[model samples]
Target: MKLKFLGKRISGILAILPERELHFDDEIGNFNFSSSNSLKLKKIMGYGRHRLADDDTCISDLCIFGLKYLFDAHLLDKAEIDALVVVTQTPDYLIPPTSNIIQGKLGLKHDLLCLDINQGCAGYLVGLIEAFLLLGNEAFNKIVLLNADVLSRKVSKQDRNSYPLIGDAASITIIERDSVERGIFANLQTDGSRGEALSIPAGGMRMPASDSTAVLELDGDNLRSKNHLKMDGGAVFNFMQTEVPPMIEDLLNYAKAGKDDVDYFLFHQPNKFMLQKLTNKIGVSPEKLPSNIVENFGNASSVTIPLNITFNLGQKLKDQSYAVCLAGFGSGLTWSSMFLRMGELDFCKIVEFVNKGD
Candidate 1:
């Protein structure tokens, strides 16, 4: 799908990360592989340390904490939020939408709109698209887009494929209508046939979580239960190499712009190696695409894009405007990209989620 939005912009962004940090070396013994092979994997994948929320923390907790920080700082006003949009695969509960939970907890206005979208890696772009669409209504002005995930609890610690690099994070992006009449162009594609490449086999209504579903079993070289995150790394990598470059080309062509025209490519940080390969395939400079999120903060699903911006270009983006391309691909077999003029934020920063007691 091709999309174009005018007179909408992101005014600010905030990423909230857990205070607890875990190093790759510390978790080597948790994997079945030898120390030598584990070290090799770390070196190749750029594994360092990642933040994980504590056992009791949920996505709502992270969002609420971040929102409170903004509110307390006077960067955001409660009455000004026209809508609350949360994009996550790890909602606090299956029945009650997490957006509503956040709104209720924060005592936000009853007239505000609350929506929850079940999406992963490409969630930031998805959330932004929805936010921009919401601003089309003349009555709406400011929208809060929260992209988060707490998948550390869903993945098996014994599973080397995902555990060491799993991080939990939430990003709050403030979007509002702009009078400047700027254009935001984007494209999205999905292949449901390939959805199983990255999914948790059991959890939803089709297969409820049971004792049998929670039994850890050998999945090739790793151990994980049906409730754990299952990833066909090779399939996903191949999909990215094959599908993303063309998508970027199509989007650029549709927008009548070339790759060089984009000042930065803020993409999802699955890991360093995969991002490097995609950058090469897309014919862009490595410096333009940042891949350090996984090493420093892990892959926070849809939150990676916003986290990347706040981590890598926070200070620069606060006052400067740039033509940027944002892309995310994974989980749901979805790939989406957007090109827009962004920056001059009211604020951009990351805050540690301090525990209530600590």
Candidate 2:
């Protein structure tokens, strides 16, 4: 779908990661590969290290921590928050939405709308669209768009193809109405036929977790149990190579924006190899497109977009105006992108969980 945003701005973006860092050398024994194979992966997948949450941590915990940091820093006000939208595949519970849990913890207004969207890579784009649309209501002036997931727990330890590539993270983006009008343009799409290319086979209504779900199988390079995350790496690569470039082209054309017109192109940090391929295929210069987020933070799903904002252009975004093209692909067989320019954000930084539960 093509989208347009009016009277809206991404005022700030904050990302938090669990402080526990895992180095490749320490995790070499966990994978099913030889040292040489692992080294190759490190070089190709940008897998020197990635962070993981404590066994006791949750996505809401990370997101709440980030919100508190922003509030403490006076970057945002909890009382003024009109809505909370948390996009995650690993919510705290299937019953009450994680957004509600966060709303209560943060002590925001009772009337604040809370929604949970179970999405992955394409999540941030969709979350931003939701925030912009909510601004259509005259009553709602600010919305917290939280995109996060503890994906490490969903991947099996023995899965060499995926376990090493997954990382845990949460990002909080504050969107609000600004007098200076800058419309956010977007294009979101889904191809369900290719959904199975990346999925968790169990723990859902169709296939509840059971003894069968715990059974591990050697499915291609993915040696994961039915309960673990699965992926047809080749299929995902092919889709990125063929479909993603055109999607970007369509988004730019629909928005009447050019690749050169964009100051930065931030994309989901799937891996170094695929990013390189996409950069070449899409004809985006390496200087304007950055793909090292996975090398430092891992493929943090939707959080990667904000992570990129803070990681590569955090200070710049906080100090000046620049056109940005944000894209998220992989998982959901979905891909989406948006174009916008932001300046002088209230907050743009990454935090480590210093006090785990806090």
Candidate 3:
């Protein structure tokens, strides 16, 4: 899908991360990799450490915490929010959407618009698009777009290929129709035939959880079951390289912008090595590209994009302006890229989680 929307601006972004963190060294007992090999993987995969929620925590907990912080900080008011949209694969429940739950928890007006979208990785771009469309409605002035995922709970600790790379995070982005005429130029692509490249195959209505799905067995040197997250690393890497570069080039052309015009290229940090390769292919300088979110935060799914904003551009966003090109690719075999100018944020920061959610 190729599209564009005008009059949408990002007022602020707040990303919340769990307090409990896991380091690569801690995975020795969970995986079969040798010490030397584990160190090599850590450097190549950009696995410095990743924050994870406690066993009882859910994606909503982090999101609600961040949203409340934003509200309390006076960066935004819950009363002014006319719409709430949450994009997550791991909702609090299988029935009532997390967005609906959030609306009730926040005590927003009952007439508010609440929607939950199930997407991964590309969800940030998808949410931005949704926000812009909702802003078109005069009745809906302020919109909160939330993107989060707790994929750590979906993977087996024994699966080194997927476990160490997954992290948990949530972000609250306030979007409103701005006076500036600047808009978003975006292109989205997907290939469901390759959905198995990254997926959790069970626990959905299509394949309800059963004893067979719960049976953990050897997958190469690692162990996983239908319920655990799975990824064909090689296939996902190939997909990224094959589909991403051209998409970026086309997006730049669509917006009539050059590499030099973009101040920062904030992309989904799948890993450092892959992003370095993609940056080289795109001919964008390393200074203009930040690919190290996975180094400290791991891959927090769609939350990775906003996580990048708060981590890398937090200070810049406070007093400067920037034109950014954001991209996300992975689960759902989905890929998306957007060209937009954003800065002068009312708020931009991250908060560490505590026991409040419990």
Candidate 4:
């Protein structure tokens, strides 16, 4: 369960994105209809700063800012990174993938291996595992994994049930083979059958764009047309309650650690209610759960877990034997959990001495 760390390192992590303050009133409750009918209703409650056009700093830009900040903080030489991976379901463009866009903006070498993953929520963990494997070969040294998803663009603002809950954001974490921690212990899961429960019905190869399709309407905060995110909320919740706890337990067992041994539980920030439900079912104390950013950012899709970790680094995580469990469940109805042992920065010694009035 222990990994050798001659030099394996987590160079840095950064979350760079604006806070989305979405609001809604109880009047939305009046539209209680069947799932199909509900899908057509304008459900999104509200949005913060909606006037900023799509071209103004997209999720990709936020991701790049995070990566750049991490690289600068770690003082990494530009020539050292050998590979880059970007994970997202909402890429900036459909043609060249966000990874290529990031590579070009960052000025990374064209020869450096670059790729994109079309995973939904589990994308970050899957991308991290891939980065670790590439580093483990010793052929590649430093690797950057960037995750960003702008779900707001796809969410039908007209749908009161879903519009108020989706947000946009991005995060980046750099992984190296020989630094601070082992990063991830493998125990990832997927359920393709349930994929239909959480997905966008159109805009893919199966349902390509067509002139016959009606022009999607944006009604206030809700989407008033055909193109919109569809979800069977009850089914998704059932899946999470039944499947996630056992998967996490198994992952901890494989790591040779108990639930109590874990210092922090960082689940995908779907919402405060969902997080609380999962924590109670898993029997983990409320204090052990990481504070979610969903209140301010809603659900940032794949970027949630990493952003939560980065934002809370210095506050709740000082010199602790931290066990980080990341669980991402969304779209593809896909879910994954990875365990890692994290050591906090050594700042206590300085704080202790300085506080003595010396």
Q: How close is each model in CA RMSD to the real structure? A: 1.0, 1.3, 1.1, 8.0
- lDDT at residue 184 of model 3 (Cα atoms): 80
Per-residue error for 257 in candidate 1, Å, reads 1.3
TM-score (all chains, Cα) for each model? 0.98, 0.97, 0.98, 0.80
lDDT of 2 by residue, 268-353 (tens): 87889999999998898988899878878778788888888898887887888888898988788889999888778877888887
Ranked candidates (lDDT, high to low) = 1, 3, 2, 4
* C-alpha local distance difference test of each model: 0.92, 0.87, 0.89, 0.65
Question: Where is model 3 more than 4 Å wrong at Cα?
Answer: none
Q: Write the per-residue lDDT of candidate 4 for residues 1-358, one digit (tens) a residue.
A: 2222234545455555653233444324433344455333323212222111143445566666655655575545567778878888878888887888888888888778888888877787787777877776767988878787777777665566466566676666677765444545656777788898877777788886565444665444344444567767779888888988888888878777788877788778666666778888899887778645665556677877866676565443445546677777777767788777654532111000011111
The candidate 3 region of ten consecutive residues with least summed lDDT is 349-358
Q: Residue pairs in steric clash, candidate 1?
A: none
Predicted candidate 1 versus true structure: per-residue lDDT over 248-343, tens digit per residue: 999899889998899999999888889889989898888888888999999989989999999999989988988999999999999999999989
The true-structure Cα RMSD of candidate 4 reads 8.0
Q: Give the deviation of candidate 3 from the true structure as CA RMSD.
A: 1.1
